[model samples]
Target: MNFELDEELINYKEKVRAFALKEFTEEVARTHDIEEKYPNELRMKALHEGIIDFMNPWKTMIGIEEMCRVDPGLGISATVPYFGAEVLMLHGSDYLRENYLAKVISGEKMMGLGVTEPGGGSDVAGLKTVATKNGNEYVVNGSKMFITNGTIADFFVTLVRTSKPDDPAKRHRGLSVMVVERAFEGFSSNKLTGKLGVRATNTGELIFTNMKVPEKNLIGDEGKGFYYIMEFFNISRIFVAAQSIGIAQGVLDRTTDFLKKLEASGEYVGEERKFKLAEIATRVEASRLLMYKAASFLFNYKPNPTITSMAKGYASETASFAAETAMEITGQTGISTDLERFFRDSKIMEIWEGTSEVEKIVISRMILKGEKNE
Candidate 1:
């Protein structure tokens, strides 16, 4: 497959680079890092610039990679608002699209995806959140942890169980997804602090205590939430890979600069340094290719499950490894606040979207299925 980006995509990348460099300045980045505050102004700017509406999953992934290459936190701030809105844009009702998409694109309303709960992280089917039907409203009672953009989201695309235990033997069939507005009487959110990284994204917890969600808020159909969630993950996993690749690229750029400066001063002796640089570059390129392949699959609307899993797993692992190499190359300077932040941030990429272990399991399952079919 051709790995080179077309002229149009290259032009798009250049535009993204220019915008990110201008809008996400080092000073602004530091402020967000120090205060653990979300970059709302920057997010609004991105929305106005149409960066938030590049609905093609691949293009959005590329845009995110470019912005995050400069600053992960800034990138997160720019794209976090799109997480829930994208689901609605792709699969939501007409009323949902008209009511939410425009406001989300304009930054007037923010949204979040609530899938992970305090009870389980990777075991999504084990979620304890429940939404029981009333006359015309669904009464939701549950709490979600580690939700991105939760503190500021005007609404959430929440997963809940709507079926009884004896309804079916299928583990994921009883679940349903709903849109819960923050204005509901029993809806609340609390900001979570002291995070390992991505401090600017405003991680938080969402609580729905008998929140009355209108029947219209239900997405698709009851007992199909797992499928929708999986579908969302198919797209989201690619973006997560993009984010990881971006961080890896950032670390590579910084390390290359440092190596050039050090080599110029004759501080490093021999081709060992050169060899290490070349190796790191090779790894970075491979990771980028995997990410692009995953994006391409998404663009074609083909479910390349193995490729997606490989992209997410490999990109994340490569990022973590690259960060470690960067630290080794930069020595004590790598431990500085900036590099350390990247180091810390790279870890979450492997764990979120799906853990590295989960990715492995997904890949293994695909391989086993293929073999059985043969």
Candidate 2:
């Protein structure tokens, strides 16, 4: 098996890294992070510069890793405009694709995914959002919490319950995915501020009060939204794994430089800190390998969900571990520098796409079902 990245991917990785280093400057990153503002300009710039290429999943993965290595907040903000585009690409109708997805791809519009409800964190099936059929359209009512690009997106690929389940045990049934437009009369959003991490990416509560969505906006078939979302999660988790590895690598880079500088200044660095750095580097490398394996399976259309979960779960934990351990190594200097921002940003990696606990559950269940990692 080939372990090295192809020459093209290597060059693309460098291109993305250079773009991020140049554009995601310390001032720009700090401004967005401290003000809790979305970097719309960087988003547009990334789009124009071909920094966000979804057509090539490998490029997309590498770009996320490289950009986020520079700054998670701005990096994620730059890439997430097309967050839920996969659902549309795989399951949306031609009309939905041409009208909505095309615009989003061309950067004429932005989109978000609406799944997590205020009352439901990882319990996607427990979401209370309802879309009652009314002739040719569905009237939606409910709210989604902590949605990325919530307040700014031109549209949302929203999951809503279409009918009551025949059996309470099958709450996941009768759910559907719909493209809800921001201009819908009953749609509103409240921007959420003071977030713990990734604050450069917009987060908000999406509320729907009798919001009307056309029947044509339904993605795939009715009663199939749960499966569609699950499939999307399988794909998204790989990108999240990339994001995690990026954070971990970034932390390692900073910590190593710090130690080198200290040693250059004739300071005696302890063995404990050296060991921590070594552990961080090892975890980062392992996370990348897992992510690459998961990506290879997924992008080849022979997806192994167990491996995907393992990659995401392990990488996310590694990001958090690397950041925290860097803090321990750097002590006061860590808390005072951008490493502090990295620490704050590393947290949400374990929470979003799927929580580390959620990933563990997926991994165990798949293993019990006789799924084996290749």
Candidate 3:
């Protein structure tokens, strides 16, 4: 019932905000967006400065919100170097942990999660990527698309099918998770360009042709990657909500500043503009509450997937709404300012993690099933 941050978290929030303001400068964000480049240098800077403390989920969540509020591209780029760490932390073998997780945590290596196949889209269970076990190794073939950190990640926690299900209805049954190294032969990536938003984040296509992954690289049990990834998505969607909330708040900040400046210079401030700002602020507050409620359930280990879906779906919608309203309120300046970039950045929040449509399905199914635990 309590919505207030404790002293420690309050201090941490300020620290993260300060770090984002200082490092993710407007010029740096603008340059990265223009070039469609990854912010590897900024990532390294944040890592070295201890801004990315994975041991504390609260810090990570607050850090994401604060950083994204400053600039979505740089903020997401800075925080997602170890994007698949939770999978490793929960299910990886000791060898995988010592070799892969350690290196990534130390900032010596970058990693990503690969679940979306080229043709799969959001049909996670329908993915065609296959990994046939060959005695001591698994030979993987197929390709992944729209993968974050695809071109630069040293390795990927990839999901692939190991066998066909005995029951025709259970297409999700034979999936498995594994650590696939970039150094392995027959693995290649092609960078994707000209994204509409969050251009500072690295994205590319991953192709696997007879790529060899050691048998020991398998995470948890075979034929459980579907469940593992679903679990990961449930947790990750909270961060996506945080990102959405941040973008919404960022829109609020910029619009307020713009309106204030207009008023200061003797421009008329209309009730319509005030109403739009009020609506955005209310949604931002609601999104924060929903995000916190979802995160509370999830981080505490008693997750309600329904609440998570609601939070992500609503927050992402709010982000897009806020951005659009910001444009209308800012008028001509929106055409030539960071508001355009913010508008672009707001869109991907709904697409990545889970589309707003996907989230609606999750929410609807759960609600209709009499599972209104939220």
lDDT of each: 0.84, 0.95, 0.92
Q: Which lDDT value does model 2 have at 351?
A: 98
lDDT of 1 by residue, 277-363 (tens): 677788878988877777776677676877888899999898788888888778887897477777878888999889999999998
> What C-alpha lDDT does candidate 1 achieve relative to the native structure?
0.84
1 versus 3: better lDDT goes to: 3
lDDT of 3 at 173: 97
The residue pairs found clashing in candidate 3 are: none
- Model 2 C-alpha lDDT per residue in residues 1-374, reported as the tens digit of each score: 78999999999999999999999999999999999999999989999998888899999999999988999999999989998999999999999999999999999999999999999999999999999999999999999999999999999999999999889999999999999999999999999998998989999999999998989999999999999999999999999999899999999999999999999999989999999999999999999999999999999999999999999999999999999999999998999999999999999999999999999999999889998787
TM-score rank order? 2, 3, 1
The runs of at least 3 residues in candidate 3 whose Cα sits more than 4 Å from the true structure, single-residue gaps closed, are: none
Deviation (Å) of 26 in candidate 3: 1.4
- For residues 1-374, write the lDDT of model 3, one tens digit per residue: 57799999999899889989898878999999999999899988898888888888878888899898999999899999989889999999999999999999999999999999877878998998999999999999999999999999999999999999878899999999999999999999999998999999999999999999999999999999999999999989999998889889988999999999999999998999999999999999999999999988988999999999999999999999999999999999886888899999999988999899999999999989989675
RMSD of each: 1.9, 0.7, 0.8
